[model samples]
Target: MTTTSKLIHGYEVVIGFETHTQLATQSKIFSRAPTAFGAEPNTQACAVDLALPGTLPVMNREAVACAIKLGLALGSHIAPVSIFARKNYFYPDLPKGYQISQFEIPVVQGGEVEFFLGDEKKTVRLVRAHLEEDAGKSLHEDFIGQSGIDLNRAGTPLLEIVTEPDMRSSEEAVAYAKELHKIVTWIGICDGNMQEGSFRCDANVSVRKPGQPLGTRREIKNLNSFKFMQQAIDYEIRWQIEQIEDGHAIQQATVLFDPDTGETRAMRTKEDAADYRYFPDPDLPPLHISERWVQEERALMAELPRAMAARFVADYSLPEYDATTLTQSKAMAAYFEAVAKACSQPKLASNWIMGEVSRRLNMAEIGMEQVPVSAAQLAALIARIADGTISNNAAKQVFDALWNGESADVDAVIESKGLKQMNDTGALEKIVDEVIAANADNVAQFRAGKDKAFNALVGQIMKASKGKANPQQVNELLRARLAG
Candidate 1:
């Protein structure tokens, strides 16, 4: 928990998270049913998934491997032995009367997620991450007064990561969520596709007076987007505070956020451990993982984002912020590396990628994988800037041409657009001389120690040269002429 809590309405907001990350395995948790999305309902649920009579559960090895990978990534302890329990629950979409999940001895235990909330590092400690099988979807859009059950998602492999109530605000919670999302997607365990329900967050939110005991929390379910996650938490915090201020006792319940209404409504009373009636599953034995298996999985893992960012800082001499921004995704980091290596200019490459490339990507609402400009093209453009073939402004023109598919060759774009800088010293000297002669008053101000006057003269020289004059050369020539 954050000690320096910024109270809202004289109450400290407390938040914890339960994230359901669907593992990227080819099959379900206990069956061989295909785990691909977009299949027709009831077609993918096998006998084992449907809990048919005499069909015993068989654990998927790949799912356990994925769990181990997550444990390693989060610095969690991977238990050599863990138990699967039957959680008794009644839902229309749950074909099995109970969900197979971990109750007491979860596979992963005692880790923490670290993230930057606007330059202040925040850490959210993990209570546990357990393996579980997902329930099916209850579809209600197409039917009137009747709902459809899609068992295709039943028995899907999932890792439910539970966090301590550490976050004190919506922004901190969102940052933590984003960092966790990046880690999971970076390691290839989960796709981190919240839109398709592959990644989901349930936030438990409450508010209490400073130094008071923790308030009763209401769990907001299945937040699919980061935007909605922050919004829901903010609203819930305000609601809880309002209830307390109005002398109403806050109830502990599960709630759902209505994005359309921007308010959360109670779904049902939250269930405790006893309410679920959890018991060890008799059909499946205890899960046993060997130390050798953990080592093998760790060896197969790629360098994580944090380590990659640190390397960028050390190897490329980049600022911490630049390194962090560049490594937002694997594709982005790979793109930066390719451009930097080709041009042998890491700082210049970092500037362009974090500045122009990021701007275009945001405007197009696309990821780095969908960027139109290739690494070679960007490298060529950066090389031109570094070699004084063009100015920064001219390089932007070349970048625009490449991004919009107007031209593929950077040199061709520069030649056609007449973006090459005026490198002739004699010609630049002549332009600078003429500008000084034309602007006598500005010259006198510069001699009088006014710096803006010198800038005005430089601007006039560039204008007289049609913006092709090399700025460095212009500055040097102007200083020499004024001195003489």
Candidate 2:
């Protein structure tokens, strides 16, 4: 490996993550407004969310319970009393000059979330995880030359999980974020839909000489995509190393990602916690959850993603790779189980899902939930292969047609297209004879033990069949004929 590829200078790369998980509540945190996505601009806003005069913030009990469940799951201390504070900021989308967030007395503290760095499970320490209300969004469009504001997502309940600066590499940080996202989604608290802005993350990055005081840190803001998060960290690490190499000091500032340019641009100087002017909100009362409420929330917790992934491995007798891929999404796991029950070999189902289904989704730039193919349909196709009704090559054709954006029946389409394999030995014999009679020179070369000449005969038979001949069957018959 090149020095640049392996060396991060004499300094070590350090990362701390702040992940925001949007609660799966039907309404906004502080209002009765519906919390739906892709709605008309500013339509979901209620008086409290819009900051109308005399309006008060009403806390959602469901949101509070969800946060408590996460806290317990992380093995953190759930403070019987946690206060809300105002984080002062200015933006068109933020109707209130300040956002309601947790500062001093957050709900949970000093917990850990464990994820695999490779084969080993490494736990990342958490500083805190707190409940907060999200701010609105500001959209800048190229066509209109005017910025638009969308309040549909504003005031949504958010659980911000902050971690200590324990991650040593970008790879570790990305892994930790992915694991945390799964836990939140699995618990049914947050949906963990990154593209929809339901689950997002920010990284606090810094570099320092071996055992030196921590270098100045920069905040990379609001990255929702995992791949983008990894790339952003990598670029920032390179940028920091280069700056130090050139005697330029690393500035403490907030940065924004330019996805188009594959770079992060300066947003503003990174603010200290003191800069937020954090103070408890007098308008709202402290949250006091009794022991009875805690137990009820505990009962609501479901099987965590890691445990569930392990169970799938043992119960289904699936390979670690297959289990990992299937459990990447909750929806994918459910789909896998349905097919696994229908088919005896869970591994077979896993292979088809990871191979064809995943390939089509990636090619079409869609999600598994949006895929046109279904578990039952895929199982039915697998049955056809086992029953010898279709060859493996023929089955691939049917899978392709099913994903081709048509309501095409798999068997009917295969029949209509004449995609069935030409397994008829009598017809194949006549074509093979005609090819050998026509190519006398090639036949002489084949008899003399030239394998390449023998291949030409198989290609001829396929061409005669318009590429529909069963290749294995053709090859077997031709070898028997050519030997005699």
lDDT of 1 by residue, 179-285 (tens): 99998999999999999999999999989888899999999999999999999999999899888899999999999999999999999999989999999999999
What is the C-alpha local distance difference test score of each model? 0.93, 0.84
Backbone clashes in model 2, listed as residue pairs: 253-270
Can you write out model 2's per-residue Cα lDDT over 282-364, one digit (the tens) per residue? 88899887878899888877766666778889999987767876887778888888888886668778888888888988998
Clashes of each: 0, 1
Worst lDDT window (10 residues) for model 1? 1-10
Best-fitting candidate, scored by lDDT: 1
lDDT of 2 at 243: 89
Q: What clash pairs does model 1 have?
A: none
Off by over 4 Å in 2: 1-11, 37-55, 72-77, 88-97, 110-123, 136-154, 168-172, 182-186, 191-196, 210-213, 298-302, 384-391, 404-484
> What are the models' TM-scores?
0.95, 0.75
